[model samples]
Target: MKPLNPGEPRQVGRYRIIAEIGEGGMGRVVLGLAPDGRLVALKQLHAQFAHDPRFRERFRREVATSRLVSGAYTAAVMDADAEAETPWLASVFVTGPSLKEAVDAAGPLPVESVRLLASALAAALTEIHRAGLIHRDLKPSNIILTSDGPRVIDFGIARVAEDAQDLTGTGAIIGSPAFMSPEQAGTGQVTGASDVFALGAILVMAATGRGPFTGPTAPQTLYNVVHGTADLSDVPEEIRRLAEPCLAKDPARRPTPEQILNHLGPVPPGVAPWPPAVHARIRQQDAEVRSVLALPLPVWRPPPKKMAPRTKKILFGSLAAVVLLLVSGIVALGLSIAEYAKPEDPGVASLAVTEAVSPERLRLTDPCKVLAGRFVKESGTLKPESGSLHPARCKYTGLNGVTFNLQLGESVTVSGLERTDRTAEGLPLLRSTISGGCDSVVQLPAERRFGIVVSRSGKEGDPCKSADDMLTAALARLRTHEVDRAGDPASILPLDPCAVADPAVVGKNIANAESAPRTLRICEWQGGGNTLTVELNLGAYVADGSPVDLGNGVTGDLRGAGTTKCTVHWQHRPLPNREAEHVTVMMLGREGSGSSCDPAKEIAASIVPKLPKP
Candidate 1:
């Protein structure tokens, strides 16, 4: 939370503002102290959106539904003024990071932990469903990981059951594609079963690290949700047995939340529901909020200058590089975090894993030959093309904008395996999609990037099935060996950019990034209408835009315009060093939406510290 700025009002109605919690396109949220000394999370809508009649109407309906939803697993709304000049609502303050944050940082949960999460969330859905409301968006971020248990939040898209079919069935696609139910992914009618389906997907993410239905883009993911089977290979058998039925493509085939409760039994009380690491994070959050409470109030404090992006300490750990391929909807960009946790320690605080080379490694000559039939020659299908030679890859074109990709890279150390979501065809795969794309890696003793990525060029649901299929097909053709050296990429190109990326770092900027392999060096993410693209130029790039002093003697360039034309650029491991490497992250968007450089700079600041020291 940030201190209130100059001119920022300290009072809102009967509550006094304490600190700024968060701000986004929709509105800003603050911590407020009620007259009785209780804390509340107060959300104030933007003036423009608040003034729109349609927005107000929707807000009014949502507030009413939100009030009706009450349970131990859900946030309780205390008050709201929908008709006010600027609409606002106050809910019991929750001090914790989101489930998305928890997983993105720490990776997936163990079986027991996932079971606990599923039980609590199932109970939450039961209460919400009984209230005649269907939460259209039920993904990881919507659930807050509190000290007690998980609490479901964000009901802006929650709809009354009766009208759901009428609106959602008309092909007006919405909701987070990764967690969407089959019907919710397309023109099919939505029902309570839809939420059930999403719950199943959520359980899979909690269990392994990813949702069941996945793809490269929203459309591709949704298509997979509608046409493909949920990949349960990675999920533990016990959880998978329960989740499998819930992910049925036909909504009617899924079980009700009440039925889920029967199977799950009840969550025990008074005990911590998460692992030691997750609980530690929860405690950290609580401590931060308590610290905020200790500050004095009602002073005309001087405006604090925006702090420059701080520099981090140099490290000398035996680190594995990452190659990240991020995808998005509103925006698309990819980031590779060469900085990571030490290989043996896969925790968020250290470098994770990416395979460079190992003695027990196998080399791949052609990655495209694996998917001989997955791509077809049709109206929109383009012939297959070979990709980079360093890490070897193949790209195939398909009809109606469908495309498939295959890439090969060396393994990250064994510590990297601790964070995998599930295993497919005996291969360990990183399950979760920070953005929305579907991707998987083959099981290799020493490598972290035996990967196959299936990304389309638009918004899609989680496309795990397609990725699974690609992996399965590739495995049929995969050949390995016992080499003399550790596994590493043959060359810079064709390497999985995501293998070297730090999700903890990227999650800080792009909350829901979906990525794909645009090329050997370029990875892209589709975000909430913004795109983030990253490339490793390897001495090919020469900065042209004016330099941005991000402080500490570091600089980056800003250039371009709009969603598709603008670019954000910066170099990693600058010149003068024999070991210097050239890497850049660029965001492309349409014109008139403000400077893309702003976010680009923000991303650069976050990524810089993770790079290897010169």
Candidate 2:
């Protein structure tokens, strides 16, 4: 989850948005707090879709049908507003990572966990099909894995079985490429059976990291969906027996959700459905929700009423007399207290030197910038490297490479560290020795801590002194160069990528183009058999690929993935901890469209100038 951006609304109907949860081609989902203290996952349609009357009518109908769906493994819809300017729907928020994230982090699930997942999803499909609706998009990303069980979510594309037309009426694909059933890829005649086929593909992904019919590209994958056989060689035998029948090309040959459930039987009692690592993620999300709820609510005040001339005069006269009396009382009180006031103890005064790091300041601190290479050059000719998977840590490389890590607003425990009677920027400094390296940490208020570690290749220099010097320099730079989102609202951190491109320009490249946010910082526009993607990212700026001058003092690295796709990457600015803010623009064209890079360059040239200057 990420904090809401600058232009994002704080409230949607009665639900107060806490943070963004996820985004997709259709809409974005956010964590919301309802009036009764219940947390919900609220999904709001993109403005482009809300403006279309046909899309709004379809969404209203789908929402009404989704409200009728209820089961042990499905997130129930709590509320909806299809008539609003930006239509939204709220559903019970389930705490867990999506199945895709779980698989990516922990590899494939074990046999027992896969069994439990298969059973729960089948039951969820049963409930959904019983509601007279077919879930058009049922991929791994739509399933949330909880400790108790798997809960299916994101019914944004579900519709009645009889409605066979696509949303755009131009035959654009609506579901994931690898997971779409053969019928959906070809004839577009979807039914309950299509979801079963998707379930089979998901089961294959859960047992193995790849889908059953996945190919080199999306078009190839779609073709495989229509013609190829299921690759069950990597799948465990136990799951293979159940998944084989579901993957039959003929829908009539596939088993119903009820049959699949009966075959798997009931989930075992008292046993956790997810693996230990997945359960740990679920617990983390649960704690995050609690912390968000504990924050103080924003105060709401009504607009002041205007008064007539006579009433204003009377009020001013009465306020003046009250101020005069209050001023006289304060003066008398100060005189009485001055005689009794005493100086504070020196020890007590010294203890108060440390400044508390406010939550607002911590949120805007870019971890990558805290220990930048320029600040650490005295120790060695260091260069910034790619950051770790954890967003709070950054790595540097040179004769003496170092890493800077931060743990903010969380309980921090330090062990094997010798306390020193020293301070860095008024905060207590601690030192520790490690294998071939030394570590130094600066302790802050509210359990926050920042550490710098220096590693020496040989026993030539004092690692502790290097660590300390780097930490001190970082602290000094942080005090002055901290990222200020309020002062620079135009920073990519707050701007929506979908709004960066001009609609007219986008249409000139691809007729009938429609935009959707693929993630918090990434957006995609698709039409006319072409796709353009814009992404705002933070990483090391590698000077690989061909350099193209994107006017306005900006240059980008252009690389081609294949004949049909090309991408351009450019660094926007240097961020904390050595990483740089960057932008990526990718273009994917139809099979015979020669040199996708031309169109990609054109689009990049148009949008790069619109971005905020470094």
Candidate 3:
């Protein structure tokens, strides 16, 4: 069977498919519209898996278990067809991206975001376990940052032990290994605590760009997970303390889901009060069951009322005596129960809020000193050569170095080499900015700016073109170093390699011209550090003769023109200083414009070198 394409409209039962939202090894999930035009996410298991009778039975059990659970933080399932040829289930569609994707695209999320997310997800787990279900897979991918809060999804593998026939196979891994609980990885006995372990992993990932355990091989990673301690030195104290217990190697030592929820602080009353709507629905379904069960008609029989007068009198007298005794007993019992139910000395109840910690201060020594003497300051321009343009003034560790304090919507640039008598502090402390975009931030190392080369291209639209030769020389100064991980294969890119390739000059034809259809490629290079290069290829269908329109932005008419294949280039700053904010680079095409244009690179060069004097 063909997989569903994005934005292609179709229907399964009452659910109308809108578009493909995401996919994984299990199956494809589509953003669907119901008959009433409400949005939903429809997850369809692959036809191959649907053929397995055991899988179908497990899926049905999952549906029943989910129906029994209720929570605002969990995605509600609207409909499901486990018996279908290609079984599918539809749930309320959450708007934002997954935690992993968000962090990948925008660095780490903020502290507030992390706290709120933790509380919400823990509450969701509370509801899940309360309903007698355990969510086996609770990694970042299953968490959606919706408008209200983070919603946990994909309950397909949730198990109700009594109903489960071990459909996933004994000892088969169900969740992402990096986030899996020890019990889950070893025995496949998924309990609510598994989600707690996953939550701990999520917190680390939110604080750092990567997960807790990274290894070159899966076995090594698993071993590290099962035996090694999590490296959470980079995490803030408040968060680290709160999360440490969740990752306890011993399941017994781990906090329960309720305990985790309590640690998140209190939720206002009535937000998700008792007797949730799901419970009501369950009761209604039970009533329907009762009606079905009672449908079996019984043989009708008439009662005979032909008793002797004396016998009737005796029976009435006995009944009256019994009623008097029952009334007295009921009164006595009610009094005893009411006295016991009296509130016992209202126990002290106080709410504790999670603490907020400030950012850390980076220390420097004399060899790392940044000299203000090297900068060339003009009335409206600040020019920094290879050894100039230190951004801050600070004294620490018997040396004067540049102090870096970046705030939201603000940025500072550093240039210059710090040569130390010893090899320990030879490289420049500032390298590149570590950010996924405007909203996220990551940290980079400092040894990338030695032995510089600089070059400039004399192009009109190219801001750094005049200094192309010097810039190239500066680019040549960078050397690559590899940062290897153990279990996971994804690598972290560094700032040095970014300096080599001019992001502005990489794909000029595709992005500079209007109506130019081009394929953009971002390739990561291997060496001393991580490097990414972008390539743009023009397509034949794109009309080069006429102008095409690009979209709008902060500056008016962000529109571009022409069908020329313009390739834009950009390299990421490996790690941003504490105060350095993230930046977004957009590629636009216009008619008759030169091919080598990178919005981010152009902006960085034009604005960076000309920063105002402090």
Measured by TM-score, the strongest candidate is 2
Candidates sorted by TM-score, best first: 2, 1, 3
Better of 1 and 2 by lDDT: 2
**TM-score preference between candidates 2 and 3, better one:** 2
TM-score of every candidate relative to the true structure? 0.49, 0.50, 0.44
Candidate 3 global TM-score? 0.44
Model 2, 493-548: lDDT tens digits are: 44456766766778888878998755445789999999999987656777778999
The segments of candidate 3 whose C-alpha lies over 4 angstroms from its true place after superposition are: 1-9, 163-165, 267-614
Q: What count of clashes does model 3 give?
A: 60
- TM-score for candidate 2, residues paired by index: 0.50
Worst 10 residues of 2 by lDDT: 343-352
Cα RMSDs of all predictions? 25.7, 20.2, 30.8
Alpha carbon lDDT of each predicted model = 0.63, 0.73, 0.48
lDDT of 3 by residue, 241-330 (tens): 877898898777888877876776875543422113323433453454345334432232332345677998999999999998986887
